[model samples]
Target: MIEKAEGTFESVMRAVRGVTRAVAAQVDDLVQRPDVLVVEFGVELSAQAGAVVTAAGASAQLKISLTWNK
Candidate 1:
């Protein structure tokens, strides 16, 4: 049970890291300068361990505010 929980946690962390890297790459590739602000980043995870099942999942969202400087 503990091993499964650890695996799930590691998977979640890797997903978070990948998302962060992708977001940063997108920002770096922008050719036009725009005022951008990250308003919120959130992650929620839940797990259920039962006699016959072990399930885990996560939901995440990111909100950003952008203004055109032109």
Candidate 2:
């Protein structure tokens, strides 16, 4: 049982690390670009019962919502 739980935790951590790397890379790319607008924020949860889930689950999301003048 302990071994199975450890394996699961390791897998989850690996996934989280991968996601963090991808996000960092994307943000770096946007930073290098001149005409890139990035908006990021986190959700503030007041109270929760059992499982109150939201989109991305209170994460830091980057949104590029801008149009270039052609």
- Model 1 reaches what TM-score against the true structure? 0.59
**Against the true structure, whose TM-score is highest?**
1
Clashing pairs in 1: none
lDDT of 1 by residue, 10-62 (tens): 87778777877887777778887567645456877676665311465678887
Please write out the lDDT profile of model 2 over residues 7-66, one tens digit for every residue. 555655676667667756776676344354444433232224543232113323434443
Candidate 1, residue 69: how far the Cα is off, in Å: 11
Q: Which stretches of candidate 1 lie over 4 Å from their true place?
A: 32-40, 48-53, 65-70
Off by over 4 Å in 2: 32-70
